[model samples]
Target: MARADGPRTANGPRTGGGPRADGPGTGDEGPVGGSGRRFAPWLPGVLIVGGVAFDLSTPPPYTAAPFLAAAPLIAAPLHPLRLTALAGALAVAAACLLAEFHGVRDWAQSATEIATVVTVALLALLINRIVRRGSKRLASARGIAEAAQRAVLPVPPARLAGLDVAARYVAAERDAAIGGDLYAVQDTPHGVRMVIGDVRGKGLGSVEVVAIVIGAFREAAEQEATLEGLTLRLERALQRERARRADIEQAEGFITAVLAEIPRGDSQLRMINRGHPAPLLLDGEGAVRQADPEVPALPLGMGDLGAWPDRVEELPFAEGVTLLLFTDGVSEARDAQGTFYDPAVRLRGRRFAGPVELLDALVADVERHTGGGTADDMALLALRRAPVAPGVDRGR
Candidate 1:
């Protein structure tokens, strides 16, 4: 039961995929390599031994396939060139022994052939070298993805001018990028605005939609005079994009989004629900009320078929009140017995110091519920009106 911190140990041999999922990311493979690390080392040994066994039994016609056998062995870069070189030598040795044992050629000819095989063995080390560099570059790309994701979806700073903001995004698949769910929070001259939505598909295509939607929200949230106007703008933007690129809405591609704008000096939250799951507003004391608008607008992109009539819903968000906006992943997540996750009931009245704490707790709870990974991406954005007092300086 010895559990080591994952994704923390400096460029060393990766241990097994210990116990926890959210634990530190191990290996030099960035978060992409976080899912499994426990059995990585033993793989090379098993393959090398198996290759040697095969060589002994068959010999000629069967060249020891080092790459085939030990491909996963030298997967991480930290392993020395020696391991690969050794693997290659083993293959060549098998070739030479088989040449002699099977009497395929004369002794002198066999010796010369084995020398060529040995040279090829060393050359195989170069392949390992190239793979190692490639892994490093891939890890670097993953880091850039993390930074972009943060900037695009800022973790609500501990405090905003008039709101408390906290958020988290979890990819449905392990080691995946942002995928299908997206959330954004920003404070504009008009007020504190937020958007949370789920795109139709997964992978890079869904991420592209997320980028387009957020880009539209950031631009429209500021200029538009009203929340309804903002909704119209977003719907049109989506349709315009679809019209220009007919492939955008291919098969099944649409976005379910909920946009909220808190006027500069009001406790009311003007929300325009666009076929998304209703968000919940938690009272300072931990009571939950589903903030579903009466007139539900169509999911973005299908707006041309029908006008997106926006309805503003008002909720009494007192000082320290928190509004939790989430994609369907959280509510729809099921346990072993098929019980759905109840965020309101589970986190009722719990005091999360800041956004990081809130997200950490939420992810931990979700992992516990699903036992490890959720099938669909989960995105959450929680905004709490900072205790309207004059003591703490809230981060933007």
Candidate 2:
């Protein structure tokens, strides 16, 4: 079956208001105010007032010096440098007032406390400068990660060969935008080919593997006519990558992936699984089942461990049916009580309008299950066969 053609690529750099692969954010909101930002305007006031009350209620030796000193340091990261300086001035002024009220202005302890406040206020200003510099560096790092993510996993076109498609990726580390999880979709001579996989390990090494696998897939998906042939190409690609790295990575590296093909004008889907989690097959009635492989297989890059022929599992891909693919991050997400999330159980009996809706709901459900924090990178792809429009030709 040949690919049904229109626009082959949908997810790219946003142009003329097209959907963005990286989502929308200007990166302007920093450690400053939202709810926490609101507290900044009054935090120094509360600290100063509390300190004054403490000094007044206690003896001369019992000073609010510590609170007076802390006020400015606390404000440094949450407010502008000017505001931080103002906070320090308020703390110092509060200390002076307390010293006068207690009639201890001439005492050595009072003088010591005044000097401490002044010195700390100056130190707080320095801390503020350091923090601002770090924030700028952090923002730059985030920008680089975002760019790498977009390049490694360009967004799948929203519509591919008449299928409604959407993909989402969530990195385990919130600030780290890219990780080992990967997905790719391409219109090839055979069909609309797609792959979702997770590389073992983390950090720059895993990201490097992700880039290599994706680059290989985009090139080989067009040439390999059979799913088995495509799987072999990927295996060789990873093995070659491992050979260039140190012996430790070569010994430890492996990837679990599922490659799939949806042919035009056919109600059948072909898949090759390499020890990855099974893709979920969802029907319009909201029933869900795992598209488990007919034969078990080892993960890619582990060819030396064992030799087995890669098998292709063909399944029904009926109208209004959706295929859901994901990495282990979705399955292994744990709740506070130490319970692992099972997507099969959670998605049963739940109907979605389309692939985009299913992903939004699934991601939200996982967040609620794991209390909004997952320890592994997540990559998800949903492809659905749109119901044929009335009076439209069944065979194109």
Candidate 3:
């Protein structure tokens, strides 16, 4: 596949969830947690007051110094610098008051207790500053990563050509915005062509392959006359990428992908599967069918192992029907009992108004199956052919 250097343009509005654009770790906002986050600011005061009560109730041999020392430390990461300083001062004051209440019979012991509190308080202030600095740095890094993900996988338009479309990318790691899974859809001269694939690995290496695959697909989708040709183009792009990266070649990296095309004014869809999960088709009557390949082919980037001509299969794609494509993340997702999530089974009799509704239901079902967590990232694409209106011309 030839390398595409020119920038690509999106056909419609982008729709998908990604990293928080508002940013994280802001001082005004409480740290991430449950109900405890709401009460975090009060914890230091509670600790200080509890320490005084413990000191008074406990035998003189057992000092509450440890409890007092913990106050400011607890406040450091959760509260503002001023609040942390106030917590430190409160802890020190409590320590001194306790020391005086117990009497100054041992001046050395009293002085040592007070000194420890003071030292701990000072350390807490330093820690507060360091934590704030680190939070800011983390926020900056997250912003850059989000930007990179958007650039690599620009969100597909909600509508492409005459079909209603929706795409989603869900990363396994909470902090990650992108992963090995990728999807792209574009309007071409032949029809609306799209691709969804999963690179072998994860992290930056996988992201690089994602970029290459998408770049090649965008260019090939417009130029290639057949789905097989587009698949070959993507295969060559990965091959070229592997040749340049020694590590990828050594690892024998490959991408499981499916190339799809819907010719203009046609009621059929053509697809070429390359060792990837078969896509699901939902007709207007709420019937589901798996668009499995007649002849299985190896995934792209494995041409070195064996080579065969790509085969494009045609499937019925009538009006009001939706096609759903996704990576292994969805099919392989396991519940606590190790049961895999079967989309076909879950959506067999469920009818949806549009592609967006279909995908929304599918994603929600997958999250429920996996208990809101999965071992791999997921990329989903749904396309629906709009039904013809009464007395309207079929041809545009």
Candidate 4:
């Protein structure tokens, strides 16, 4: 069931377009304005000063009530309860002082103006309380999501089966900690087996598929004797999930994945690619090569469409060489100008101390290329064959 590559293409560098307004760098400091400055914290003070100046310069007919009312509103979301209260108090005091300075001949009008200021100030405090409560709820929700993500995709050990391993999962959506992207590595009697995949959808649905795929892989990696058999196990798992759910959408969804096996004491690794981005091989000499599948196969869960024999391709995985497997998020990442990021081309001449360094650099490079505006979740896994010492035994 071989199919052509997806429509996304990797081309030249980005041509034009400024950085995204919501791109990385704007942290809890405050919201960024059009001028790209953190002016939220100072806005209330500026408004108060401006209101005072306007009242002093203008006649009593032209009141600065609008400016005075806006000061507390501006501070509501950006400042704490105490600061917000202070801002409201200051605005009310300014209104009273201005009214007194004008020598109010109309007591009703003066009372109305002061009353309006007090009312707005009270509303601002209410807004501040609501915003703070919502923020606390959001923070608590994020903490729970992070914990779930860790449990679902627990970090692979730094060393596994004599190989240095590292993995990373980056979600494109700011509020999401986990999505359809997933990866798992396990040391089995067969050797170190790794799987990286991207499910077809997003949100909780995709997360369900991710959990199914990974759960199947962990169990199969221990029992399956070959990469081909292991791939079948994953396909069956997804098939069962769809059958159990009995939903048309779940039935239609598929997962693009790569299964890799590194036999103990062997200098080569075997891989079975199921319509996924080809893995990259980086050698000690800082040269990179792509391990594209000899024959493409449809992604898993698409067995209903067609079936083909899974082909296991062997590649050199000698000492000081690192193998990188990733989801389409990395390969399909586009810049402001729509040029897809090509990891092989970008990492061609880069040398890293180990798998951890390699993945860190790749993640940073992808963020830079996309200007931190990736539209999908990314999952990356890299494993390096540790260099053997002069008299060290290579046997497990």
Candidate 5:
């Protein structure tokens, strides 16, 4: 997988329309966005033996010996190639010395061997140049990818006022930092509303849809007082974008979303589910409950079918309650035997000191269940409300 940073070229300094230093805006988009690079590893011994054999077999009065000396270039860049060239020269010199062991060394023979050695040495130098240049390019590419990722998805804060907020994003495609998974939490006039959604597919198409959905959610969630309205707002926005694309209807793709509004000074938490996996509520007393919607909720982008938003479910998410919202990457994560991960079963009765601990434990549990490497990208978002004062909202 090639990284989205430094791009690959056929050979030489491959040129393309790049960001001009004095151009209009910052060109954060790399040649390859998100997808990592792939490289073929070189074998050392094979090239060395082949080079020696070629030198031995070829009837060369000229310096094909130098080319053979340079054989190790196939294995590495500058450092090893330079060493190999020097080693080849020394070997040739020693071989000549041994041939005339009984007598003084011949000038003609020494000159030919030395010349062959020097030729190979120059070839080694060429290999060194290639390696040094490659490393620099790779480093530059890495820097670009890092900058772009930060711009695309900034790191979430450790805490949000009284709420313990933790969020993470994983790339489905190898080396990709930003994907279709998106989340936004803002303190609005109504309340501290939040959204977690997974757009359809991956790559540029999904990213575009994710941006659209997030933009709509952020705008509507702040303005709309109710979760139902926010759901409708996101759906309508997705619908409008889909209508613009000609081939959008031909495909069956939608956004699975979970929207929540935490009212100030209220133990009850209001949420609207749009066909997404129900969020997990981890209580202070070591209890876990799946907050599934009462009725079958349709995913966003299907408003044309006349699906109704379920009434906002207000669960008792009192102080010290942690809400875990995730994408299918976590719920649908598969084990070695091809079994879907059951968070409810695994996290049952588990005790955690804080929201961070709960998230870390859950992530580790998922990794252990799947043996470390995950096929799908998982996004984990945990929010824990602090324990209120004694008798706070108790009679209310």
Candidate 6:
């Protein structure tokens, strides 16, 4: 709730299935890294030799059975099925050879050691099969999750209503590909309009609300004549959704959002803030302005508490000035000592050639500040007014 000087802070409609799925990306590195593959062939050999040496050095009653048993186990996840089988065979053969060298080949203990190696070898092979199967299943699940993410949050076109647009959604969880953050940009009859919002909670519930908000925004952005009108439509949509849910969910669910409209043949932009973060306006000369709302209003779905008329704040939308919109993930990112990240301070004088570079820099700066320890999901959208051609009109 702390306000900063003009530079206060730094910095999708999808519809779909009953429940959403999520996953991280670590599984993609399965068995293919330089270090892993480089040592793969020699690791089994080293283990076998080490097991032999341990067995030879130990007293007659003691054994290196554990080391001998581990050779195939280590190979199961890192090597091919045939290589795993070979590792198991080598371990069994080594145990047998040691038994013979010690003159215990005919002893019951030797047979038991040999049998133990064989049983472990077979189990290692089974483990190899299970790991491979799991990897395949994981790959399949990742693919489906990515597909769902694309369907729900389609990438905005590079150009929208004559403005350059770039958006990014970074999930806080490493394995998670998507979260509750959402954005949508459309070239509507009224001009170009965009909405960015953050759902209150996480998981399926948040995703469901995101779909509802985006679906409603898309429908209203094209038809509503004013930014305030579109916001009212979004509020009604959230209210209807709340009505469909139980009392607990109705009491808890809410969405913070910012809606903007840039009318054609005009040099100014209009915005409606519904308890969302103020967007930063960056000029071509590297100046920044925080477009905070003049009248505060509750986030979407809290109309029951109190209702205030949405105020449309208008600001100059000069050519080459980029407008940045984001969720609390960016504003609330804390450093190790708990100091909040100030995008206004970090990016005050720094300039980027375009929206993409600006967002890339901002994200990198946040990571550096938090030492890569962000707690909430972040969604960023950067829109810049394209430079007019020598003969083109500035507003048309």
Against the reference, the lDDT scores of all candidates come to 0.68, 0.82, 0.81, 0.83, 0.66, 0.79
Worst lDDT run of 10 residues, candidate 4, spans 1-10
Instruction: Give the TM-score comparing model 6 with the true structure, all chains together.
Output: 0.82
TM-score winner: 4
**TM-scores, each model vs. reference:** 0.71, 0.85, 0.85, 0.86, 0.69, 0.82
Report the Cα lDDT for candidate 2.
0.82
Residue-level lDDT of model 3, residues 189-307, one tens digit each, is 89988899998886677888888898999898888888888888888888887888776643436899998999888999999999999999989888999999999998888888978
Give the lDDT ranking, best first.
4, 2, 3, 6, 1, 5
Q: What stretches of model 3 exceed 4 Å from their correct place? A: 1-33, 250-252, 391-396
User: What is the C-alpha lDDT profile of model 1 across 1-396, one tens digit per residue?
Assistant: 001111111122223422124221222234245454554444445444554454445313333343223333343243567776666666565655555555543455455555655665565677778877888888998888888787677666656776766788888766565677888877887788889999987667777777888899999988988888888887778777777776575423488989888766677777888889998877656567788778766787776576535677777767766788899999889899889998877887776765467768888998899888787889988887767557655433
Q: Please write out the lDDT profile of model 6 over residues 78-163, one tens digit for every residue.
A: 78799999999999988878776766533655666677778988999999999999999989988887886787778899877679
* Per-residue lDDT of candidate 4, residues 1-396 (tens digit): 000211111121223322223322232234544443466677787777876775565433455666678888888998999999999999999988876666666666667777888999999999999999999999999999999898889999998878899999999988988999999999999988999989898668888888888899989999989899999999999888888886526633699989999999889899999889999999988899999999988898898887788999998788888999999999999999999999999999889988888888999999999997688899999999999788877554
Give the TM-score (vs. native) of candidate 1: 0.71
User: What is the number of backbone collisions in each predicted candidate, taken in the order shown?
Assistant: 8, 1, 0, 0, 8, 5
Quick one: best lDDT, which candidate? 4
lDDT of 5: 0.66
